[model samples]
Target: MAQAITAERGQWYKRLDLDENFEVVAIDRDEECIEIQYYSGEIEEIDEASWELLEIAPIAPPDNWSGAFGSDNRVEFEAQADSLETALNMVDNSN
Candidate 1:
């Protein structure tokens, strides 16, 4: 059965029974087709008949201890800053 879907611009969706995620880049309601961009930078048009509305779970930021660093090394920099702050605080307390 074709799932009933309402495509909205800038919404993320996943294919039924698939792990890949896509964002709705455009919608042509008059033609009943939606343009989607994949996580891999691939873009394609899918007829409304082939897709359904997907409920995506909210993603949480990585905890400080987690090793999942971003491309800019933000996590490592934050860790170093925190350590330096702690050491400076200890020195200040000892004085």
Candidate 2:
């Protein structure tokens, strides 16, 4: 059976088409807005119409929820990614 999609706060979802993941961070009924935080730490507020159009399905929490540091540390995280590659290269050269 296909599981129904619910917009409850803190729920994680995988956008099937984009192959991306995000979480429901907030919902304001008065404003008819839903705030979501992507795994990459991008925040977006969507209205009911937009939310209905999203082709998403509920999913387990990501193994690594680095969205905690969020977009604020995006540059720093990106730098660390480069450092990770450099470390891998060093390991390869040591072989």
Candidate 3:
């Protein structure tokens, strides 16, 4: 089974098609460099001075539990995603 990204840091959303194989794309931002894994994964490099650890929930299917306390839980569900590359390409070619 595919793994859900447990954290947001080092992780970014890409709309690349998940069904196809493609070369990795490199992106540079300030002093950080990131590798687009299409729809698979991402690689990011951050300065040690700026690195911080944050707790993140792992991706999981919905449990259908509902209540006052469960309201926030339902919000954490993730939906299906298209290829990250396709989405980025659309933005790049847009006028």
The candidate that achieves the highest TM-score relative to the unseen native structure: 2
TM-score of each: 0.48, 0.64, 0.23
lDDT of 3 at 20: 25
1 or 2, which is superior by lDDT? 2
lDDT of each: 0.54, 0.70, 0.32
lDDT of 2 by residue, 1-95 (tens): 33446697767898887898987777899999998888887888999668888889998876555454344644555455544334334434546
lDDT of 1: 0.54
Candidate 3 regions with alpha-carbon error over 4 angstroms: 1-27, 33-51, 57-82
Q: Between candidates 1 and 3, which one is better according to TM-score?
A: 1
Write the residue-wise lDDT of candidate 1 on 6-81 in tens digits: 6666455566445766666667889988887665567889777665544433222223322222225444455555
- Give the backbone clash total of model 1: 0
Q: Write the per-residue lDDT of candidate 3 for residues 6-94, one digit (tens) a residue.
A: 22322333322333222223445565543433222233343323322312232321232111112232233222224334433543454
lDDT of 2: 0.70
Specify the poorest-scoring 10-residue window by lDDT in model 1: 61-70
Model 2 pairs in collision: none
Per-structure clash totals for the candidates: 0, 0, 8
